[model samples]
Target: MADVLSILIGLMFTCTGCLLLFGSSISADVDDQLTQDFKRFITVMPLREMFPWRITSMNYRTMAGVLQLSSALLLLLTSGVLSTIANMVLMVVMGVAMYSHWAVGDEINKLVPALICFSLLMIRLFLHLRHMPKDKKD
Candidate 1:
């Protein structure tokens, strides 16, 4: 069960990374829809006033999105020493992405995706941390 659980988690991170990566190449309308969808989620509503924003105003978020997606792909395919290093790099990229979203006026109302991404990064960090050597007492 433990082995299966570990595999599931790893697969999920990889799959999620891939999923977000794929979102990058879509059209501007599609990207706008995705951002609005994210906003709707953070507001916790089946229905709400339509979001009053354009994804175009924040081009950096899209760049961040690609970075995150690529990082996720790297984390999924990579293994051994390279895998660990890649996963750490992925986390850092995603962290920058999360920051980019917040830096813009995307609003806390659009924060669900950011939080979800952060959670994934944290999991990757935990997995990598467990594989690291403990510090020695001086």
Candidate 2:
């Protein structure tokens, strides 16, 4: 069950990362949508106000995509501690996504996907920790 869940999460993140990183090359429509989304993200993202320097949305998108892709790869290719760490990283990313949507007053529909992914990551992490071996001190 844990293995299946990990694979599902890995595939989901991989597709999401690819969409963020390469959707512009896939189709004009996709590119337009990504552009619009990036604009909205820049306008509403709280960090923009907190930071002094100008940060382009493209750079932010690229960073997000890289983080998701790297974490997903780790989850897919490794096991035990590495997989657990990947799951935790993904959970943090999803949490930030959900928070961003809420902070911007996005509709519930826009927030649901992140909520679902966060839930799944929590469940997978729980399963991993539950099955981990405990040290027996003599």
Candidate 3:
């Protein structure tokens, strides 16, 4: 059940990243929509202010989206060491995201998604660690 839930969460993140990266409507309209959506949440103010630069420059957002999608793909296709590494990498990306949000004074509500992803990835990593065999010498 936990694994299934994890996979689903990964899929959701993957799909959202894909949309942020390659969706057709990613021009001004989408940007505007994103702003409008964020405007509804006070916690999202910092992100809202950062949205235009973040989305328009197509640098940071694009790279993060690609990484996120790649991580999700790795988990879906191969659920072993490589997948674990990818998840760890994504955790770093999300950690940076959380930091940026905090630095900009975004509210806790705005930080929840990144926090959730980061937490879940950490949990997955720990699960892997817990299952590892102990090293021993004869």
Candidate 4:
């Protein structure tokens, strides 16, 4: 059950990452929508305020896409420590996404996806840790 859930999560991330990474290449409508969405996301992200230099929305989106893609690949292709690390990374990403939605004063509906993903990641991590060998737990 855990393995099946992990695969489903991995596929979800893969699709999300691909959409983000190739958003502009897909279609004009998608590109424009992504552009606007990222612009709004950048405005809400704390890192934008913390950084000294100007950071474009596309930069944030690209970085997120890369991270998600890499982590999803690790989660799909590996097990044990590697998969654990990937799941943690995804959790962090989803947490940040939820925070961004809250910061922007988005409605609950907008935050639901991130919240769901975060919950799933937590559950998967718990299951993974529970099944891990006691010796390698440290």
Clashes of 4: 0
Top-lDDT candidate index: 4
Per-model TM against the reference: 0.49, 0.90, 0.72, 0.91
lDDT by residue (tens digit), candidate 4, 1-138: 679878999999998988889976777798898788788989888767788878889899998899899999999999988999999999999999999889878899989999999999999998888887777554
For model 1, the local distance difference test gives: 0.53
List, residue by residue over 1-138, the lDDT tens digit for candidate 2: 899999999999998888888887878898787777776776666567677888788877787788899999998999998999889999988987888788778899999999999999999999888988999999
Where model 3 places Cα greater than 4 Å from the true spot, the runs are: 23-30, 33-56
In the range 1-138, model 3's lDDT, one tens digit per residue, is 446745875797788778757655657787665444333433433354755553333455566678889888887777667777887888887887787677667689978998988888888788767776788999
Where is the poorest 10-residue window by lDDT in model 1? 40-49
Q: Each model's C-alpha lDDT?
A: 0.53, 0.87, 0.70, 0.90
Q: What are the RMSD figures for all models against the true structure?
A: 9.1, 1.7, 6.0, 2.3
Pairs with steric clashes in candidate 4: none
Supply candidate 1's per-residue lDDT for 62: 47
Model 3: lDDT to the true structure: 0.70
List where candidate 4 sits over 4 angstroms from the true fold. Answer: 136-138
Better of 2 and 3 by lDDT: 2
Query: Lowest-scoring 10 consecutive residues by lDDT in candidate 2?
Result: 38-47
